[model samples]
Each structure stands twice: as C-alpha cells, then as structure tokens.
Target chain A: MIEPGSFRDPTSRVFYDAGRVFRGLSHEAAEVDAEVRSSGLMNDLVSRGLFVDNWIVNDVTPPSGVSSVSVIESERVPLVTYPAEWPFSILKDAALATLDANLISLERGFILKDASAFNAVLRGVTPVIIDVTSIERFGERGIWTAYGQFCDHFLAPLMLEAYAGIPIHRTLRSRTDGFPIGDLGRLLRGRSGFRKGVLSHVRIRNFFENRAAGMETSERRDVGKATLARPAIVASIQKMRGLVGSLESCAPSTWADYESALPYEESSIDEKDRFVSEAAVKAGAKGLAVDVGANVGRFTGILAEHFDLVVGMDNDPGAADGLYDTVRRSDFTNVTPLVVDMTNPTEAFGWRGKERAALSDRLHPDFATWLAVVHHLCLGIGIPLDEVVEQIFDFCGESVVEFVAADDPMAQRISATRSTDLAPYGVEEFEEYVARRGVVLNKKPVSDTRTLYHLKGR
Target chain B: MTDPLFAYIDPGAGATLAQLALAGTAGLAAIGKLRMNKIKNRLTGKVSVDSESEPDVPSDESAATE
Candidate 1:
C-alpha cells in the first residue's frame, strides 16, 4: 500500500509491495533525479552511511502497476520512527545529520530542499536521511530556504525538552508540523528570553510573526531584503551544527532510577528473562517485538535476538533515553527505543492528520511483551484489565504478558491509598479477558504473586 | 503571499532568521569554533567531526542485564 504519510511530497511517493519499500519519482522530478544520479554523491553518502541506501530498479519496470519516470527501491527502515518519539540525544543526532547532509550536498553542488523531521529515520541509533528526492541543485537563492523548518522541526522542540523539561514527543502529538515558535517563546522562562539563540529564534520570530499578523501583505513585503548571501547561509548551517551539538541532557524521571529501585531479586529477574526468551522462540516471532513499559531495555535486549526489530517503549522519557543509549552501544541492529505511554499513545497527525501515522498503527509488532507493568496499568492507573488486553491484542498478532495479584506487595503499594474494590482485580479476571479475544498457549507462575502467559489472537 | 525570489523562506524561516540576526556574536562564535574544529581535523588527518565518533554524543552506558 502507498503509505498515507508518504503523500505530502509531490516529487516522489513511497510504496510498499509485498515486503519491500520503493520510491517512484514523478516526471517533474526527472531533472533532480538525473542530477542526483550523475553526481554519484548519493551513492557516496550511502557508502558513508549518511543516506539510506537506494538502488535504481533497472531490471524491473516500475513494478508494472506503479507509474513514474524512474523508480528506486530503498532499504526498508526496520521501524519508521518520528522525531517526536526521539530522545534528546537522538533528536540532536538527527539535527546534526541534517546539517551534515546539507554541508555534503553543498560540496557536491546540491542542497536539501526539505528539512522536515519526518524525512529522517533512526535505523538503529544512527539517524539517516530517507527522502532522496528532497535533494535539489544549489544556486544563488541567497537564503537558507530550510532554516525555519530546521528550527521548528529540530531547534524549538529540542530546547523545550532540554531546557523546560517538557517532553517534545508529547507536545508533538497535538501538532506534528512543529512546536509553534510563539508557544515556545511563552513556555520558556522570561530569563531565557535574553539568550541569543532564544532571543533570535523564538522571541524575535514571534515578534516578527505578531507584527506581520497586524500588517498588510504589501506593508510586510516592504521590509528590507532578508535574503542571506551564500557565505552567511553557510555560516548559519555551521552555527546550527554547534547549536544542535550542545543540547543539554534530559532530566531524569522516576523510571530513570528503576534499575536501583527494582523490587525483584536478581534470581527472580533471571527466571523471568528465561521465560520470556523461551516463549518468543517457541512462538517463532521474526517481525517486530515490542516491550511495552520496557524500563531501560532489560528485556528488550533478549527480544532483539529473535525479532527483526525490537522497539523498547516506556512512558518515562529518561528510561527511553537510557534504553536508546544501551541499544546504540550494543551490537544489536534490530532494537529501537521510544518514549510512548501505552494508555495514551501517539495519534495520526500532520497535514490533514495523515502525514504521520499513529504510534499503535505504525509500530504494530508481531508480538508484544508487557513485563511487570500490568498492575501499574490496572491498579495504579485504573484502566480495566480487559480493556488493556483488548488494546494490546488490537496491535499485535500475539501477546506475552504478566499479571500481578492484587495483594502483591508492588500491586498493593500502588493501590494502597485507593478504595478497597480489589475483589474483581485478580489473575483469573485477567485470564478471562485474554480468553475472550485469543487462546492462551502457556502460563507460568513466575513468582508467588506474578503470573506470565503467552497467548495468540483468535 | 510568498516572495517569488526567496520562496523557500517561509514564515518559519523568517522567524529563524529573526533569531539568527538577534543572536549576534553567538552565531559568529559558533562559526569560529566550527572553523577551528575543521582545521584541527584537517591537520590531524581526522575524518570530519560529523562522523559517528563525535564526542558530543555521550558514550552508551552499560545495559543493566541483572
């Protein structure tokens, strides 16, 4: 299917046939295509791992059903993750990658016409530009065309996440285009108003936008030529590299201390890991495996060994960032870490709310493992067990999860201050929910109070 | 209502340039730092600072498997 998110770019459209991903260039993009091909810079960038590798499909005839002047097959990104879902460091890396691409493109007589965050995807931990068609011939436009987009898509969100402690991913759920500059200006403290980057990018931009809003189009046009010379634009790109490179570290969340606050004995943890690995191997999972509530990726590392891609998702931004660091350092090429809350996941947003797919729809895993988090979801958050199971089954073919007995220490502690309505919240009630939608393949009592079950959708 | 010659610079670009103009020497300092890094890399025969080995991104902390 031609992805809904791939429709905004008119120069090219991405399509998936069977299991492979391909891009079809419109006749209008023929010149850009030829320029990219003749230069061989795309291939060079691909070799250096800066650009996602794409090959011109010479042997095939545009896959017969597809129509275009030229067709190229791109290596399928294991998971199509968005910038909103990225950690501070990952977002910084993407910004650097964009500037790096611009610098390299300039060297090769081209420039990236689009700097949207959606154009880049994380393969493992490294950010690679996926949209090859965005590259265009560089000329004397005398302005950095993508400067504003770079700020909205990269700078604004990173600053908020870094300085204000607001999660960029959550903010992006409302508006995928970018965090509005005016909103950012207001959100940051008044003290930050004096900072140069903030002064120029946020405060001044808001000033101009507000002033422009009140002025007639003709009057606004009367403003002096803001076109930047080549050297100035080049300097701007270099300055952006420095700004992106120095983003402050994200503050730690409660889950950041999860490793030290872990309640389980080490032997019990090992047992749980063994149970999870054996269940995955028995189920023959190979597509995507997600560890929902994967605090710091303790179990995601095991899931990565079996699945083509493993997404470690958690609500805590700090935990997700920690997991990203862990996965990036390891030899595992199949794992990605993202900040996502299962209760309130990311929805489809962007142009007409279809430019970027919803988190549940886009990262639909073949199997999902929810470890030591069901109690927190049920007792701590008050979401019904049946609803949680149904939601989990809605996105995956099979699910492996654990249920904590209501009287367990962790469950009790979480629900301690709540009402005494604990009669209906038990392992039996949880199993009944699973049976309604799927078949239970195996169930193991991992501990005195915790039970693990592997189930397949009916 | 876009400028025909500078059609690429949208309102967002205007905002960015607004910020860059006000940033003053901060931008210049950044550019100078970049030039020094480039020269250092050139002298040491090191690959460009954009490589995966950049020290700006902290090294991965060991995963707690236990």
Candidate 2:
C-alpha cells in the first residue's frame, strides 16, 4: 500500500509490501537518482549516517501505467515522530542537520528541493533525512528556492521558542507546514520583533511574501529572475547556520532537575529501578519498551539494557531535552526520547487525519514502564485511575506501574494546588481499577508511600 | 520522463526574490569585511596573501535549468 504521507511528490511514491518499505521512482526521478548516485553523494550521506540507508531493488515489479521504474528499498525507522512531538533542542538539531545536508548537497552540485522538517526522522538522538527524492540537481536559479520553507518550517518556530518563550513543539502540532511567516511576524511585533533574526527572517520575509502574493503572474516571474552568485548563496546558508546555532530555548526549565530533587528517599529510587528491571526481564524484554514519564531517563537507562529499542517519553520539554542530551552523550543507540504528555498525547492529524498516524496507533511496545506517572494522570490531571490504566494497557501488553498514595509528598504537592478533594485516591481504588482491566503479577513496596506493580493486560 | 522539474512544494516567489536580495547584501558585507581585514594586516606589518583578489572560477550555469 502506498504510504499516505508520500502522495504529494508525484515523481516518487513510498509503499510498504510484506513488512518492507519501498520507494518506486518514475522514469524522470530515476534519472535524477542515477545522476545523484553516480556523483557519489548518496554513498557519502549514507556513510556519514545522515541519510536513510536504501539500495536499488530490481526484482520488485513497478506499479501500473508507468513506462519504467527504479525501485529502492529502505530501512524503516522504528518509530516515526513528527516535529511537533520533538523538544526544542531536538528540533534545533534537526534544523541544523537539514541545513548541513543542504550545504553538503550544494557542494555536490545538488540541493534539497524542500526543507520540510518532516523529511527528517530521529533515529535515537540523531536525525536522518529520509526523503532521498528531495535531492535534485542545483538548477540555474542561483537563489535557493527552498529558503522560504526553511524559514517557515524551522526558523520561525525556533525563534518563537528562543525569543518569546513559546514551545515550538506545541505550536507545530497544528501548523504542520511550519509556522506561517506572516502570523509569526505579527506575533513577534513587540520587543522580540527587533531581535536579531526576527527583523530579517520573519518581518522582512513576510513583507516580501505578501508583496509576491499580490503581484501578477508575469510580475512575479520577472522578480524570480533575481539571482545571486554561488559563493553568496553558500555564505547565506552558512550565516543561517550560525543564526540557528546561536538560538537557545528560553522555555522555563521544568523537571530538568527532577532526578536531583527526588521527593522519595535515595534508596527507594534504587529499589524502584531493581523492581522495574526484574519485571522487564520476567516479561522477556526483546522488543520495544517505553519509559513513560521518563524525567531525565533514570529508568530508561535500565530498560535500554534489556530491550532492543527503548523510547523515553516525558511531557516536560526540559526533561525530554535532558534525556536527549544524556542519550547522545552516552551514545545509547537504542533509545528514542520523545516529548509526550500521557494525558494529552499527539492525535491523528494531516490530510483527512490519515496522513500521520496517532501516537497510540504507532506505539505497540512489548513492555512499558509507567514509573511515578499514574498519580500525575489521576490526581494531577484529574483523570480516573481506570482510564489511565486503560490507556497504559492500550499501548503495551505488559507494564510496570508505580502507585503513589495520595499522602505521598509528591502526590500531596500535586493535590494541594487543586480545589477538588482527592481524599479517596488510595491503594484500594488503584488495585480495583487494575483488577477490572488486567492482572497484577507481582507487587513490591519501594517506599512507605510508593508501591510497584507488575501488570499484564487482559 | 520529459518533465525535468518536480518541485512539488511551492517555493514562494516573494521569498525566492527576497533571498536573492539578501544574498547579494551578505556577499557585499563579506567583501567589505575581507577588505578591512586585508588593510588591518597591511598596517600591522603582517604579510598575508589576498585570496579574494584571485579571478573567479567560471560556474556551470548550464548544468540544469528550472
């Protein structure tokens, strides 16, 4: 079946057949592919681990109506995440990687036709460009055509995060095409409007965009003739890289230091780790394992040892960013960190809400660790214990859930902020919900107020 | 097979035109900076080769057309 998201580009179409991913290129796209391959650029990108590994497959039959076809098979990304689900640092890194890829392509007499953030997928902490067909020969149009897209898809959102303290991940959820330049321009119209990149990248670009929009087709074509020298184009891209590199997320740090300030005793932390590890091993952790509420990835590190692939998810941008930094620094090749709130996860969106699959549909982990997360969903978010249990079972077959009693310091701290009484939140209520939805294989008391349960979905 | 261009996403005409203008400005600024550095080196009695003075290599403009 043709990949729903791969229909926009007519020259190439991505399809899956019998668990294998394939890209069927038209005769025209094949010629471009041959040129790029012959130029040795593809091998260079693949060797550097910057591009997805794909090889020509001659055995696969082409789809009907095409005169001829060149089929390429690709290594599928374990989990496909959109830019909206990434933390600030992850998105920043992806933007830099895209620019680097484009710069490298320019050196090889080619350029990326589109600068869409969707073209890149995070494998572990590294972002790899998956849209091989986006590369094409650098045409005589001496200006980079995808400049507007880069500004829209990367620069605008990043600037908002850096300047206005707005989290791009949340903003990007609805604006898949990246933030509109005009809207960004108006939003940053105060002091931030005069910030370094804001004036040129957002305001000036938006002005030109509006002007071009109002022009006649003939007038616009005349303006399109405006060109620059190759060196100048390269310099502009380099300047963009410098500007993007300088941006730092100004979003207030939350849960970034959660591990440092544990509400429970230090021994309890180690005890919880042991319990989670034992549960994972008992469940035969070989497939994907997710560390939900993985603030700074204390338990994600443990799951990484047993599972083939581990995903560390946290709603806090700072926590997810911290996890990404730790994973990259430690060179953990199997863990993918995501910024996701369990209570309000990413929903299905895009063309007919079918182009991009929702988070729950994509993640079917063999094992999951919901350490210190249930109380936040139930007491903090006011979600019922049964509903939280059902959501957990929906994502994984088996999980290690940590139950924090309402009297616990952290739970009290969460409940104190709410006007609603959470006095009924106790061990009995949790176990009843678990019994209704699944079976608890084992239980261990990590602390006076916290207990770990190894649960299997019915 | 005949169509050489497959630019599916519309590269905004205004943005493209603005990029050309911006690149030109950036190029001029770089040249100015290079000239100032060259002058500074001369005053400081540091002999340095001015690579910017070299002739430009001809580019392959005919390689591909949109």
Candidate 3:
C-alpha cells in the first residue's frame, strides 16, 4: 500500500509490499536518483550511517498506478515516531543530523530541498535521514531554500525549550507543521526574543516576513533577486550549527529523580527487579519489548539484555532525556527512548489521521513492562482500572504490571491532591479486572502495598 | 515537464530576503569580491569562470511563481 504520509512529495511515493519498504520515483526523480547514485554521495552517506540504507530494485514492478521509472528498497525502521514524541535531546540530535546531511550533500553538488524533522528517523540512538528523494542536484540559486523550514521545525522548538523553558512535545502534537515564526516572535518577545540565535533567526526574520506580507507581488519577487554565494550559504548553515549545538533544555524534569526518591527499601527494589527479570524470561527472549513507564530506564536496561530491541517510553521529557543519555553513554544499540504520555499517547495525526499511525498501532511487542505507571494512569489520570488493564494489554502480547495500593505512600501522595475518594484502587479490584481481560500467570508481592502480576491477554 | 527544482514547502519570500539581510556585511563583501574578480578578469583578458559555469535556472521564489 502507498504510505499515506508520502503523498506530499509528488516526485516520489513510498509503498510497502509484503514486509519490505519501497520508493517509487517519477521519471524526473529517477533521473535525479541516478545522478545521486552515480556521484558516489549515496554510498558515502550510507556508509557513514547518516542516510538510510537503500538499493535499486531492478526487476520489481512499481505499485499499480504509482508513477515510476525506477524502484528502490529501504531498510524499514522498527518503530516510526513523530517530533511530538521526542524529548529535547532527541530533537536536538535529529536537527544536528539533518544539518550534517545537508552540509555533506552541499559538498557533493547536491542539497536537501526540505529540512523537515520527519525526514529524520531515530534508528536506535542514531538519527538517519530516510527521505532519500529530498536530496537533489543543487541549482544555481545559492540561497538555501530549506532555511526557513529548518528554523521553524528545529530552531523554533529548541529555542522554546532552551529559552522559555517550555516542553515542545505537546505543542508539536498540535502544530504538526512546526511553530510559526510570527507566533514564536510574540511568545519570546522579552529577553528571549533578543537572545543570540533568536534575535537573528526569529526577531529579524519575523520583521522581514511581516514586511514581505505587505508588499506587492512584483516587489516580493524582487526580494528573491538577493543571493548569497555557496561559501556564504555554508557559513549560514555553520552558524545555525553553532547555535543549535549550543542549545540545552532548561526545563526541569519532574520524574528524573523519581527512582532516587522512591520510598521502597533496597530489598523491595531488588525484589521488583528480580520479578521483572523472571517475567522477561517467561515472555521469551526475542522480538521487541516496551517498558511503558521506563523512567530513567532502570528496567528498560534489563529488558534490553533479553529482547533484540527495547523501546523505553516515558511521559516526562526530563526522564526521557535521561533515558536517551543512558542509551547513548552505554552504547545500547538496541534501545530506543521516546517521550510518550500513556494517558494521552500519540494519536493518528496528519492528513485524515491516516498519514501517521497511532503509537499503539506501530508497536507490537512480544512483552511489556508496565511498572510504576498504573497508579498514575488510575488515580492520577482517573482512568478506570478496567480501561487501564485493557489499554496496557493492547500494546503487547504479555506484560508485568505493578499494582501500587491506594494506601501506599506514593499513591496517597498522588491521591492527596484530588478530592475524589479512590476506594476501588485496591489489589483485589485490580486482580478482578486483570482476570476479566486476560489470564494472570503469576503474582508476586514486592512489599505490603505493591504487587507485580505477570499477565497475558486473552 | 514539471520543474525538477520544485520545493515541497513554499520557502517564504520573506525568509529568502531575511537570510540575505542576515548575511549582512559578509554578504556584501562576497558580492564585492565576485564583481572585483570579473573586473580583474576583464582587465587581464581572461575568461571569468563563474560566469561560464553558472547554470541558467530560476531561483526558488521565481520557480514558485511559475
């Protein structure tokens, strides 16, 4: 089937046949593809792991009615995630990778025509550009056409996080096209609007944009006549690199220190680990495993040892960023960290909501660890226990769920803020709901107030 | 045939102008250097390399208009 998200680029379309990913290029795009390949740039980028690995499929037929003169097959990414599901570091790394690829392409007499963050996919910890068709022969126009997009998609969001201390994932969820500069200008109007990169890329650009909006068509066209040399263009991108590289998230993570502050004794913590490991063994050591509330990835690291690929997911941006740092520092090639709020998980977005698949639809894990997350989903978010059990089971074949009693210190702390009585948040009621939806294979108590159940959906 | 240099997203005219403006004095220096090279080449009866090699393609904004 034709990939719905691939429709924006008319010259090329992505389609999946059987299990492999393929791209059908139009006659013009095919010519450009041939040039890209012949120039040796494709091989160079692929070898560097900066671009997705793909090869020409000579004998294969293009999908029906999809215009193509040539077909190429690409290595499919294990899981596809959007910017809204990425932490600050992940987004920053993606932005750097995009710039690296663009700069390298420019050296080879080619350029990335667009700099959308969607073009870059996180392959484990590494960001690789998957949209090969975005690379095209550099025209005589020396100005980088993708500069505005780069700023809108990468710079603006990063600035918001770095300067305004705002988490951008939720904002990106709504503004799929990236934040508008006009709105960004007003949002960062005070001291932040005058910051180094923000001053030039945001404030000045906003001024020129507003001015251009008021100009006549002919006068607007005259603005395009102003050009820069290739060296000057390179300098501009290098400047962006310096600014983007220096940006760091200033927002504090709520759950970054959750594990440290846990009220559990050392023995209880060790017992919880032992239970999770035993559950992982029972689930079998293969395929994908997702740690639903993998804050700082303590259990995610253990799951990574058994499963071929482990996706560490957490709602807290700081915690997710910490998990990403762990993955990079330890060189865990099989672990992918994502910022996902289990309550309001990433939904099907883009055109008709079919362009990008929902997060749950994309992950089909063999096993899952829903530890320390149930209480938050239940008492914190007010999602019923039955609904929570069903939603957790929906993502994996089997899972180990930790039930934190309402009277537990953490649960009470969570419940203290709310006025509603959480009477049904007992171990007995949770087991009943779990048994209703699926079978409980084994049950182990970590402490007087917390218990772990190995469960499989019917 | 469709223009092969088509940009999927419209690179705003304001952005293009803004980039030039951001280039500031350095951009002016580069333009000046190119003009000087052309003048020097003419004085020495040498062919200008950039003039010969530059492709006759429309800028991104101009192409968007088309």
Candidate 4:
C-alpha cells in the first residue's frame, strides 16, 4: 500500500492500508523523530491545525525491505489535491502556512527540509502539512537549502499568476517539478521584472545562473562554497513571506458580481435549491459534490450545506476568487472554489504522467450538480446535448441537471450568433437521450422554460 | 560523527549561484572559513555540531556521562 509520491524522502515513506496513512521512518530518521518529539513543536503545530497528527502504531509490521525504527499512522485524506488545482487564495494560504511553519521551526532551532508545495494538503480551508519527515534540525543556517525549492514551487508560480496574469494551475501543471528561474525571468521581462521581489528572486537569480554557466567548473564550485549568515537567511525567509503575502489576484471582478446579474426570480432560486436538496437526499449523498461552472457559487453554497465536501469549479478565476473569499469569511469548511475550464479538464502530469493524477481521477463524488452550465456547454461551447449529458455522467453516476430550453432567454442570448438549427436541442430531445442510457428519478419544471431532472446512470 | 537527525541535501548549482548573487564576495569568503573550521575541528579533535556548541557536548551529554 505504498503511496506512489512518498518516495522523494529517503528518511521516510507513507503507506496506505485499511484506510489509514502509515509513515515508516528509516533508522537514520529515528534521532530526528526523537528531536521532534522532544522539541514539542510538532505537537504545538498539530494542536493549531497546521499539521496532521500521527501516533505510533507498534503492532503493525511494515512492508519488506523497510527497516523502520518507528511506524506511525494517521487518518487518510480522502482527496489529495496538487498545487496545480488550487485557486489563488488557496495557494496564497498554503504559501503563508509554509512560511509560518518555517518561522515556528526557526524558534525551535529547526526548519523545513523540503518546501515542496505537495507536502501540504487542505483540510477544508486550513492548509495542513502532511509530510512529517520534512522537518529537520537547522545546524549551519549559513544556507537556507530549501530556498530554491520554495521559490520555485510556491513563489514563482504565485508571482506568475499575480503579476504576469498566468493562471497558477496552468503554469504549475506544465512545470510539475518546479518553475525554473531562467524561464520565469524570460516570461517576466518588462514590468513584472522591475517589481521589488521579482528582481532578486527571479531576475538576479537568472543572471547568476547564466553567469555561472559561462564560468569553469572550478569557478562554479567556488561559488557553491559561498555562504550567508544565519540571520541573513532568516531575513530572506521573512522578506519572502512579506512578498508572497502582498500578492493579490488582479483577475477582473466582473464574474464576482455574477450572482446579482442572474435573471432568476427569487421564487425560481428557491425552487432550484429545494429540488436539488430533495434530489441530494434521495441520492444518499454522504459527502462529496462537484458543482460545475459554479458562477459566484450560489448553487455551490446550497450544495455545501447538504454535502460534507463540495468543489465549486468555474472557468472564471474572478468568480472562483470571490467564492474563495466568501468561503474563508464564512463557516463553510466543506466548500472550495477553483478555476477549471470544464472543456479542458486537468490531466495527469509529471514523472510517468502519474505523479499528479488527473482532475477526474481525484474527484470521486456522490453526486454532480450541473445547475446552469449545460446550456453554456451546448449553446455557448457548441457541444451537442448528448455529449453534454455524457460528460455529466462521466463526472458522477448520480446527477441533478437543469435543462434550459432553446427558447429560454439565456439560451437565446448565448446562441444568438449561431444558427437556430439547434436541430437536436429541446427538453424532449434531452429526455429522449437520457431515457436510452439512464433512469430518470424525477423531473420538475422550475420556470416556464427551465426544467430540472434527477438521473442515475444505468 | 554524523547525527542521524541531520540530513544532507545537495542544494544544487542553481541555488549556490543564487546565494552568490544575493550575498556577494563576503559571503563567498565565509564558505572557505566554514570549511577551514571543519578541518580545524577534525585536527583538534573537536566536533562542532553547529555555531552554538561542540558536538561531544550534546545538551544531555553531562546527564549521560554522570
């Protein structure tokens, strides 16, 4: 049951068996464990919800070829999301959490050995460090070893998103290992390069890398031996925290105001929520939902109330960003909004293309709720109604979808330019298509032209 | 003596290059000084764990010795 991505650290490996996360530590890491236990830092952080708690499980024998001094187990995370799938605020929170961990480590005479963004996973809105083995005693703080990895994994991608207007997930998915400073510098040539933090962390670092490439091996080796004071390294960490902390998504707020812009009458909104909730109960949705195209997350919020976990995905970063802010401010721990264009879903990336699983693979939901996105997919994106139904079924076996008739004002507005030859488009056509492939649990008309249907895969 | 608690990470050439740019010549010189201290400690039979103390004098060493 060895987890595939847990091999990076030679000191420890994570295993999943019987629905539990077990960590096996090598003999070498025993002393580190002792030190960690003694420092009380781990306990303190865990108490604060910054890290997952692990308990020694002495009775369990580890797998072959592993000589573990200690075997500890924790509750397995149901969905492990990569940094690439996170929205702006989620990534920002993770970066701050990492820096906060480092600050706490500094006080305890230690630091994070690895600053990979993959080490942290969100528990609701809180970022928790899942890898306990990443902590190590800071001996000669002359060099912050994880600095490059941190900047590449967290800072660079963030700056690209905030300044260069590149989506964080897109940049991260392409460069799974980490964003290389050389390419980062090139992308950030003019206005972004002149920014304060960008100049040193990206541009200057690139300059040094280019300069080193020209020098002899001995010269480069000489440079490798260079060191900075411990205080300087700490200062650098502090400065970076400030830089990453200051970054805010400049994505337009047009979609943030989408809720007010909707033409749905108050009664129609109530009817939609009531129908979805009733369908959710009948579906026996114990806890997971994927709300596609969750503009301003109105339906997502309704879904969040019924489900333990709800991912509100929208193509507009502005809409997702607004939802994230709303979720953070409220007590809605189950809801998370991420920018995902349903047309081009996230694919499996990295080593062997298995490092980060595809978005579809990671999402195992009890139900999928497509409120108003079907019309957008069909009329807006020109995908056929049958194809849209197939995509919905592909997401989850049980679904509650709304059918916006071709004559609906919204649908008319969306396909105004296209031919009215929606030859195979109508409520009757949708019912016929689903009847051949699935069972229609219920169908209720919410408006003159809008109808909601609850369907289960055959 | 290598403390099992301490791990070695090859920070790679890119990181070293960044360190040089950030810290200049003074920083470069400190590396040699630190390396010389390592040699000096080896010759003098002194084990320096960190800037804070001698390796032989672990925080709980006196308790163990007694």
Show what share of the native A-B interface contacts model 3 retains: 0.38
**Which docking class does model 3 fall in?**
incorrect
At residue A310, give the lDDT of candidate 1: 88
A176-214 per-residue lDDT for model 4 (tens digits): 666787788889877777876887788767655654443
Order of quality (TM-score): 3, 2, 4, 1
Every prediction's TM-score for the first chain? 0.92, 0.96, 0.97, 0.94
Task: Give one digit per residue, the lDDT tens place, for model 2 in A143-246.
Answer: 57689999989998999989888888777985568998888887886788888888778766776676555443433444444455666777889999999999
DockQ, per-model, please? 0.07, 0.16, 0.18, 0.11
- Model 1 chain A lDDT-worst window of ten: A216-225
The positional error of residue A88 in candidate 1, measured at the CA in angstroms, is: 2.3
| Model 2: reference contacts kept, as a fraction | 0.39
Q: What is the iRMS for every candidate structure?
A: 18.2, 12.8, 10.0, 11.8
Best by lDDT: 3
Off by over 4 Å in 4: A214-226, A419-423, B1-9, B20-66
Clashing pairs in 1: A200-B19, A201-B19
lDDT of 4 at A228: 69
User: Candidate 2, DockQ to 2 decimals?
Assistant: 0.16
Query: Candidate 3 vs candidate 4: which has greater TM-score?
Result: 3
Most DockQ-accurate candidate: 3
Candidate 4 has what TM-score?
0.87
**Candidate 3 or 1, higher TM-score:** 3
lDDT of 2 at A450: 92
